[model samples]
Target: MPKALLTIESLVKNYGGGAVLNGIDLTVYEGEVLVILGPSGCGKSTLLRCINALEPIQAGTISLNGEPIRRDSKDLPRLRQKVGMVFQSYELFPHLSVLDNITLSPRKAQRRPRQEAEAEALALLDRVGLKDRAGDYPRQLSGGQKQRVAIVRALIMHPEVLLFDEVTAALDPEMVREVLDVILDLARQGRTMLIVTHEMQFARAVADRVVLLDEGRIVEEAPPEEFFDHPKTERAQRFLNTLTFETVKKKAKNQ
Candidate 1:
């Protein structure tokens, strides 16, 4: 059996006065790609934010390697280093070059030698086909390139678990595949990742397991083949059907 790297139990999160995530129980195993699929406003993004302690929970616990993640604890900074997140916005510093944006945290926050940090950053950038763009500012790159840099920035932290929240959602149709290909490469390398995305074909291809969330709860969970080919719940069937319709419509328009 695979070891559980991150465990969430009875996880509850609230927004304003209502519960956005109600009694969620999930486990992310080491070296597995777990993809979360859901409709809009189903709390997929919130779940990731809560795991990163970017959002506070109303109840329950999130544990990494058996230790609770407390937002106010002094150890929080160290804990965060082990859980990297890449967002759709590509969160790179506008004024900094790609290399600076990626190396800053390691050089300043972790106190690694500047040379060592930049070396690792360049290697990661090269893997993502952006080594030549290292000297380029965020504004100089395309949407896909910026997103790849964001992934490189996250990987340079050497995090054990990576959270990707709709990482391809903001990209153009042509740019989407390049970013997804980079993530696919990471999955093949056995990186433990929790992804929230609407790219159905990519999800089916990359996920070891697929989790379907609805109304802030997991409605179905199964291996990718089983989940996509034989979803066991009505909610899951309907969700897939809607996406299938959308995909067909988009394809027809393109043709």
Candidate 2:
């Protein structure tokens, strides 16, 4: 059995007297890829942000390797180094070149030597087919290229667990596969990850286990094969129906 690398228990978050996440419980095992699926306003993005302390929790605890963490803790920065997140927006610094962008976190946040950070960043860029573009500014790269650099930026930190919050949601159709392929490559290498996305096809292709969330709670969790075909809850079934209908509409539009 795989060990649990990230653990969340009775997780809760509120927004202006309203609960966005209501008592959620989840565990991500080492080497596991968990894809969280939910409709709009279901708090999927909030959940990922909470883990990295980007969103403060109103209740419960998040732990990594069994040690509890909090937004107010002095160790937050140290804890965050092991948990990296990539957002839907490329969020790249427009003025920085790709090399500088990817190296910034390690060199500045972690205080690694510039030469050391650059070497690691270059290797990551090479893997993602962006080695030559290292000198190019964010404005000089395509949306896909900028996103690729964002992924490299997170990886350069050497995180233990990565969170992807709709990483491909901002990409064009043609660019989607490139980002997904990079994520798939990481998954195959046994990187533990939690992904929040509406891309059912990509989720099915990448998730070892899929979690269906509705109204801030997990309605079902199952292997991708099972979850896609045999969702256990009525809410999940309805959600799957919508996904299927959308897929059909997309295909019809293409033809």
**lDDT for model 1, on a 0 to 1 scale?**
0.94
Using all chains and alpha carbons, the TM-scores for the candidates as numbered come to 0.95, 0.95
Question: On residues 120-153, what C-alpha lDDT tens digit does candidate 2 reach at each position?
Answer: 9989999999999999999998889889999999
RMSD of 1: 3.4
Reference-based lDDT, residue 118, model 1: 96
TM-score of 2: 0.95
Highest lDDT, which number?
Answer: 1
What are the lDDT figures for the candidates, one per model? 0.94, 0.92
As a whole number from 0 to 100, the lDDT of residue 211 in candidate 2 is: 94
